[model samples]
Target: MANNTTASAASASTALKARIYKAPEKAEISGRSIFLAGSIEMGAAEDWQTVMTNRIAHLPITILNPRRPDWNNSWKQSASDPQFREQVEWELDQQERCDVIAMYFDPNTKAPISLLELGLFAQTGRMVVCCPDGFYRKGNVELVCERAKVPLVQNLDQLIDKVIEKLTEEKA
Candidate 1:
């Protein structure tokens, strides 16, 4: 009976520790919510997303990724589809609920949809940050970012630092 009690207590203690040390479901991004808008087809976007996720994990803000599965599945279909419009609207709604927008624009391909999303975010007067491919410039994306007043960042390190600075300034 004593051994059984000891085993139960050990299991309970282990479970408690597991719960205590569990990582949060969503990373902190300061008090502000940021929408991650990027070209989902490019490999660089995935790398940037991973870096951004790690950087955001330590902040207090919420990061919203519309490219995520739960946001919509219309991206899998043709952009001309009527359902795509609905999805775009829904994503715009999500963007409205956010405080800022961060986008990854690789110069190799013109990400038309990302530019559209940037336009919407800009129309709302939200802050926009663009991470462009380091190798190339002078793309149409530069024009959009310029018009939107989005700061272009060269790398993930720069982006992380800038985001932190922006969040701190906003709090001040």
Candidate 2:
């Protein structure tokens, strides 16, 4: 009976909504949530957010990915654009509410926004950062994470593993 209940729980968690983005109204308020904060300037063809989500598909946590495929980084338009406003607001809310925030910095992009977000939550103890040595501002990121006592991984795999370990510990 215990084994059956465990299997059923795992099956149900797998079936629960795994990917969430720009759907604040449709979000599942239950269960633990991990806000995927990472490099988005890799290009239109490259989406690290989705890649991370796929890696952790087995986990039963909600993924808050703000990477909109159609996003256009028009700074001037964002101020008055309703869509952009909604997206940014949603991200902020999710960031605050998420149990864990996994951040990755791809060496290929400058990722200034990711850096700013990292600064915002580095000390919250809810962050797991991956900033490889090749990143332009890796030293700064490393220093911040070190000071904040946030776990810093050298690669995406470690980042994912850290998130999984942390969330699993919570369940225990």
For candidate 1, what is the total of clashing residue pairs?
6
Q: Model 2 over residues 1-172: C-alpha lDDT tens digits?
A: 0011212333444553454543344456446778888787735224656666766656666777776546666644464878777777877788888889999898888888788899899888899999887898999998999899999999888988898887667443
Candidate 1: worst 10 consecutive residues by lDDT? Answer: 16-25
Residue pairs whose backbone atoms clash in candidate 1:
28-59, 28-61, 29-60, 29-61, 30-60, 30-61
Question: Tens-digit lDDT track for model 1 on 73-100?
Answer: 4355666766566556555665666676
TM-scores vs. true structure, each candidate: 0.62, 0.81
Q: Which candidate has the highest lDDT of all?
A: 2
Task: Kindly report which residue stretches of model 2 are placed more than 4 angstroms away from their true locations once superposed.
Answer: 1-19, 22-25, 42-46, 74-77
RMSD of 1: 10.5
Clashing pairs in 2: none
Q: Which candidate tops TM-score?
A: 2
lDDT of each: 0.54, 0.73
